[model samples]
Target: MRNMLKATTLERKFPLLAVENGCIISKDADITVAFRVELPELFTVTSAEYETIHSAWYKAVKVLPDYSIVHKQDFFIKENYQPDTERDELSFLSRSFERHFNERPFLNHYCYLFLTKATRERSRRQSDFSTLCRGRIVPQEIADKEAAAKFIEAVGQFERIMNDSGFVTLTRLAASEITGQDGKAGIIEKYFSLSQTDTTCLKDIGLYPEEMRVGDDILCLHTLSDVEDLPGKVGTDCRFEKLSTDRSDCRLSFAAPVGVLLSCNHVYNQFIFIDDHAENLKNFEQTARNMQSLSRYSRANQVNKEWIDEYLNEAHSKGLISVRCHCNVMAWSNDREELKRIRNDVGSQLALMECKPRHNTTDTPTLFWAGIPGNEADFPAEESFYTFLGQALCLFVEETNYKSSLSPFGIKMVDRVSGRPLHIDISDLPMKKGITTNRNKFILGPSGSGKSFFTNHMVRQYYEQGAHVLLVDTGNSYLGLSQLIHNRTHGEDGIYFTYTNENPIAFNPFYVEDGVFDIEKKESIKTLILTLWKRDDEAPKRSEEVALSNAVSAYIELIGKDRSVTPCFNTFYEFVRDDYRRQLEQKNVREKDFDIDNFLNVLEPYYRGGEYDYLLNSDKELDLLHKRFIVFELDNIKDHKILFPVTTIIIMEAFINKMRKLKGIRKLILIEEAWL
Candidate 1:
C-alpha cells in the first residue's frame, strides 16, 4: 500500500503546489485557504455578546454559496515535556529512568484553525478539440472571481465581529501550493513526503522513524469511544490527576481527555452524518425484520434479548439521528524518546476518559483525513468501528460547549492542580447586554490572605493598560508596586506620596490657581470649611452656612480680580475672619447669636502657622491627575482622628477634580480600608 501510494504522488512539493498571497494552491490546482479564529480569553460573554458572536459566525457560513466546505479544527495541547539529560551523577542511568518514569513538566497550548473550501476548477482552459467535442465541463479556477469576492467579504465581517467582541485572529499572509512528484497524488502523499533518515523501521516506506533527525514529528491518531460515563461538558473535570501532591484528595468521579493531551495536537473530532429520514425509517424496519428472524436462533444462543430490545426501542422513541464521534489524540515530538513518553502519557490520560485507544500507526495514510477535503471515506463507518451510538441530541448538545475556559488574552499563570500556565484574562468583567462594567473590584479577606499581592497584580495590569490608578493606602501596601511602576515608566508616570511628620505631603484644598475661581472650586472650599467647623452631631444653622458660603464666594471674586497673587488657605483664612462679621450682620444674624470666633478658632489649626498648618497652608505643587499611578501612604496620619478625615476628604476631592478634567480616559480610585 505504501509503494502504491508513493507511485501516485509525482509532485516535488507533495500536496502544496504553489503559495499564493491569499490561499494555498494544491497539486490538482485546487485553491484552499486557512484562517485562525481566536476566542476571547474569557469564554464567558453576556447574552447579547454571545448572540452577536453566534450571528456573525452563522452569517459568515451562510454567505458562502453551496459546495463550500468549512473545516474548523481546534488543536488543544495540554502538556509539554522537556527531557532532562543531567538528573544525577549517574547521568546515563538517571536520564533514561526519568525520561520513561517521571511525569514531564508540561504547558497548556491551544489554537483554532478554519480551512476554507478547496476550489476544484482547472486554472487553464483546455484547447483539445476531441475533449471539447465530448462537451466536458472544464473546471474553472478553484475559487472563481465571484465566489472569492464573497468569501473575502464574509471573512472581513467575521474579523470585525471578533475584534469588536475583544477577540483576535490570524490568517496566512502568503499563498501555499503543493507540487507533486508524479502526475497523480495519493491520500498520504498529499500531506506527507519521503525524507531521508537513518531509522531502519520506516526506511522501507522512504521516511524516517527518527523524528529528531528528520525535522518532522510523528502524529499518533486514535479514535476514542465508550465515553458514556465521562463528563459530557468540555471543562468539567477534564484532568484525571492532580499535579500537586498536597491536592491528592481532590479527584473527579468521571473525567474527559479534554485537557489531558499536554504538548500534543489533540483534536476532539465529531462527525455528524445526517441520514435521510426515509432511508433511516426503511433501515429501522429492516432491522426489526432481522430481529424477528434472529429470535428463533437467539433462544439456542445466550444472546441477551432484553438488551437488544431496549436499545432498538430507545432509538425509535427518542428519534435520534446517527452521529459518529472520536477523539484524535496526537503528539508531535522531534525526539524519539520524548515522543514515546508523550504517547504513554496520552494513553494513560485516555483511560481516565474511559477510552482505550486503538493505535492507527499502521494506517498512517488516514491520519490527516479529517482535515483534508473529499477524504471522508478514510474514517471508519459507525457500524464497523467500535463506537458508542446514542441519541443525536445527547452527542450534539455537548458540541457547542467545547470551548476552553482560559481567557484568550491574559498573563500566563500556573494552574495549581495541573501546574500548566493558565492564561487568565484580568480585564474588566462583563456586564449585562455585552457592555463591560467599570473595573472596580473589592478584595476582602483576613490579614494573611495575600490581599496585597492580589491588589498589586491587578494594579500592574491596569498600569500596563494605561489606566490612571490612585491607591490611597496605609502600611506601605503598594510600596513595591509603586517602585516597580516608577522604574518601568522612568518616573514619568508613577508617584508615591508617603506622608511623614518631617516631610509632610501637603494638600492645600483652599489653594486656587491665579485667575481660576470656578463655582465648583468655590463649593468644594465651602464644603471643606463646613466639615472642619461643624462639630459631630451639631448641625450648623442655615444662617451659619449662608454666612460661610457668602464669605467663600466673596473671597473667590476678590481673588479672581487679582491675577498676580495665588490664593492659599492663609488668604482664605484672613478673608473669612474679617468678612464673616460683616456677612453675618448683613444676614441679620447678630454677633451675640452666632459666635464667629468659634469658626475662626476651628480654622486656625489649618492656617499658616497652626498645628495642622502643613496640610492646607502650602502651595498646590502635586498634580494627582497627571500621574498614571499614585499611592498616598497615610500610615502616619491614619491614626489621627482629625487629620485622617481631613486628608482623606482632600485626596478624594483631588481625584474627583482630576477625573472631571480628563474627558475620555479610564481612572481607578482605590481607597483601601475605607472603614478606617
Candidate 2:
C-alpha cells in the first residue's frame, strides 16, 4: 500500500521521468541568466544508495540564483531525525529534484529574453545620428520674395504626400529583409561551400550549425565601413555594428559566433570569403608542424633517407615548383655554404681584439661599405665608390649597421645631392671668362651684422667682373655704392639718379573695370570712363548708371575689339550724354532739375558694383639705364586696382614687342618694394 502511494506521488510530480531514470525537456525558452546547466537533479532511495547520486545535481546547483535554498526534509514535524534508511533522505531528494526541475525552465526563459533585449539595444546605439535628427523636425519660414514663394510651394507639396512615421517604418522593414533567415543562409552557402555535392539549406541564417556548437563564448572581428559587403559575400547573417558615428570614417565590429575557441580548426573551412584571416592561424600551426617534421627528418649531420630525402626529391621533380622550392632549400643550406665560408677566411678582417688579429671566416658580403682609421695612410687605394668619394673629397666616415648581419659594418656617404665637393680648391675648378655664376645673393642677416659693408664688397667684386652696377638708393642706404661705382666709371657707363615733380599720380576706379582695366586697353574703355566718373563723385543718377551700363554693353557689341579705333571712347561718352538727352526729350526724366552736380546726391542707389573714389594708383615703368640693361620704376596713377593690368600692359607695350625698335638701348625697369 505504501509503495503504491509513493509511486502515485512520484508519477504526479514528473510524468515524463516515470519510466526512465531522468526527464529531458526540449522546449525552447528565453535564457535570462549569465550561465546554464544541462541536468537539474538526481535522486537515491537508500542510505548506502546515496553514493549512486550523480555529481551533476551539485554542479547544476552552482548556476542557480544565490537566494535559492535546498531543504533536507519536507512536511516538517517538530523532531523527525530519520536516517538514510531514514525516510528523511528520500524526502530531501524528492523535494530538491522538484525545486530544480521547476526553476530550470524559468531561469532559461529569463536568460533568453535578457539576451534578445540586450542585442537590440546594442544595435540601436550603432545607427546613424541622422535617424535621431528626423525626430526633431522644425517648420521653415518663408518670405514674400519670388525665391521664398517657390520654396514654400515646394515644401507644401512635399508635406501633403508624406507622413511623420513613414521614414522610420521603411527603414525597419528594409533592415528586416536584409537580416532574415533565408538571406543569411544564401550568403553563407555562396561563400563557404567547399564541395559540389553538399547541399546547403536556406533556413540556416548564414550560420552553419557546426560553427555555433559552442555554448560558452563569442568571437568578434571588426572591419572598416568600406568592407561591410564582406558579410554578404561570406553567406553569413553577421553584420557590422558601428563603433562610432561621430567620425566621418567609422569602423564597425562584426561578431562571429564561434562556440568554442578550441574548435577553430574544425570550422576553418567556413572561412571562404577571405583565406588570409584563417591562414594566419593555420600558418602558425603549419610552421610549427613543419619545423617539428623537419627536425625529425634530420639528425646528426645526415638527412633521414625515408623521411627528409624522399620528401625533398619528390618536391624537386616538378620543374618550376622545384626551382621555387630549391631557392628556399638554398636559403636553409647555411650548413654547407655560410658556415663553410666563415671558417676559411681571415685576412678580410679589419679589426683586431686583445692584441690579436681577428680573421674573417666568412665569404658572406659584409654589409659595411667603408671605414677609415685615424691613420689616413692606411686607407685602401682600390677604394669602393664610398671610400673613393671620401678620399677624393676628404670627408669623414661614420659607420652604420645594415640588414641583420653584424660582421661588415656600413658607412654613410657624407656627400648629399645638395652638398658641394669638400676638399677640392674652387680656384682649381675650370671657369669660363665673362660668364659669372654668382647671379645674386640675398643677405638675411640681423641688424648690426655689417650687411651694408658686405653688400658693398659684393658690389665691388661685380664691378671688377665687368658688370655695370646700378644701385637703388631706397632709404638712401646705397648712396655709397652709387658713389663708388660713379668714382670708378665715367660718362653714360656711370651711376645716375632720376627724380620727378609734375607727373600727376592719380587713382580713379571709375575709369577702369573696378580698377582692373588696362587704361591703355581700349577694349574696356566704357568701364574705365564709368570708373573714373564714379571716383570723381560726378557719376550720373540712378537712371544714369543703369542706362549707361546697358548702353555700354550694346556699344561693345557694335564695335567689338575694333573699339580701339579712337571713335569708340568718343562714342561711349557721347552715348552717355545723348541717352540722358533722349530721356529728357521723351519726358521720362528731367536733366535740368537733377543735373550731373545733383547726380552725386542719388549716386549710391544707381551704383551697380562696389564703390570707391579717385586716388593715385602706382604704375610700373622700365627706365632704359644702358645699352643692355633696364631699370623698372613705379609711380602712382589713377587706380591702385590697376597695379597688375597697368604694370603688365605697360611693360608688354613698351619693352616686349618694341625691344628691337630701341637701337642699342639697354632698358631696365626697376620695381621698389615689388610685391606692391
The candidate that wins on TM-score is 1
lDDT of 1 by residue, 1-676 (tens): 4454322222322334444665555444444555545543222333344444444444444444333444444445434544445634322323453465345554333333333443322211121221212233232345367766675666566556545544345443332212223444422232232221112222112222322111365555554433442344432222234432554432221222434323354554433332233444565556656766787877632243454455456557875433234445545555668777767777776665555655556433333433443222223333122112332212211112123234433333444434543335545324332556654567788888988877876666656656788889878989987886678668776788777767887776756434465666667777778778886677888777777787888877877777554577788788777765676767787765567888889889988789887777666455565778988888888877777777777777777776777787768888777666
Worst 10 residues of 2 by lDDT: 323-332
Q: What does the lDDT read for residue 147 in candidate 1?
A: 66
> Model 2 over residues 1-676: C-alpha lDDT tens digits?
4443211221121111111111111011111111111111111022222211222222222222221111110000011112222244233323443343331210000000000001112112221221121233232222223533342343233222222312100011122221224324221122122111123432111112222111121111111111111122221111212322443332111111211101111111000010122233344445545665666556632333343344344434532111000000000011335423322221111011011122221211110000000011111112111111111111100111111112121111112211111121111121222224632335566667876665554444344433434443334345554544445444334333332345432222222222122323333334444554455445556676665555555555444455442322334444445554465567655564445434333333223232321112222222222312222233332234443343334334334322434454323333333333
Please list the C-alpha lDDT of all candidates, in the order they appear. Answer: 0.52, 0.25
RMSD of each: 10.9, 38.8
Q: All candidates' TM-scores?
A: 0.66, 0.19
Q: What's the true lDDT of residue 89 in model 1?
A: 38
In candidate 2, clashing pairs total: 49
